[model samples]
Target: MELTSGWADPEPMAEGGIAGLSPYLQDRLEREAIPKSGKDALPPEQDRLLDQLLSAAFRE
Candidate 1:
């Protein structure tokens, strides 16, 4: 659920936070968790609907 706000920010390591991590750990996390781009997120229609639902559910 890391894409399309399904989870936390897509590229959570953008600040190079993984640099201090072990090579193997960094490699594994990058390979498995990093999303390429927003275009790789959920399809447009579903993403829009999901956003609407989340917004309503979180209404102030």
Candidate 2:
């Protein structure tokens, strides 16, 4: 499926927010929780929610 738009904007981190964090913590956050470009797959729960939303919108 081609998703042309409607991607949600990521919330901006506060200035200097991550600077005080340890390198290990920063690396972990980037690798796990933080979103990055080119990663198109959503977690299964999110996929289910999206499917349900589309189904409901199109139901007649």
Candidate 3:
């Protein structure tokens, strides 16, 4: 005869998983907006946010 391990039967798995929650917060205020003066250049607020996102994603 053969012996079996103490493991139990398998369980069912879900067909799908949950989604992330960051994209919903893509606010314009957090992005680059044209300056009131109409000058065409990168917005400071976007730069700040980019730095923050990078730091948050790649921090040790």
Arranged by TM-score with the best first, the candidates are 2, 3, 1
TM-score of 2: 0.26
Error of 3 at 55 (Å): 0.5
Instruction: Write down the lDDT that model 2 would get.
Output: 0.51
Model 1 per-residue lDDT tens digits across residues 1-60: 455644555554432234323456556666888533333334335566579769989997
Clashes of each: 0, 0, 0
User: For residues 14-60, could you state the per-residue lDDT of candidate 2 as single tens digits?
Assistant: 22234223456456667787633223433235566579769889998
Worst ten in a row by lDDT for model 2 = 13-22
The clash tally of candidate 3 reads 0
Please rank every candidate by lDDT, starting with the best: 2, 1, 3
**Ten contiguous residues with the weakest lDDT in model 3:** 13-22
lDDT of 3: 0.39
Q: Residue 51 CA error for candidate 3 (Å)? A: 0.2
Give the Cα-based TM-score of candidate 3 against the true structure.
Answer: 0.26
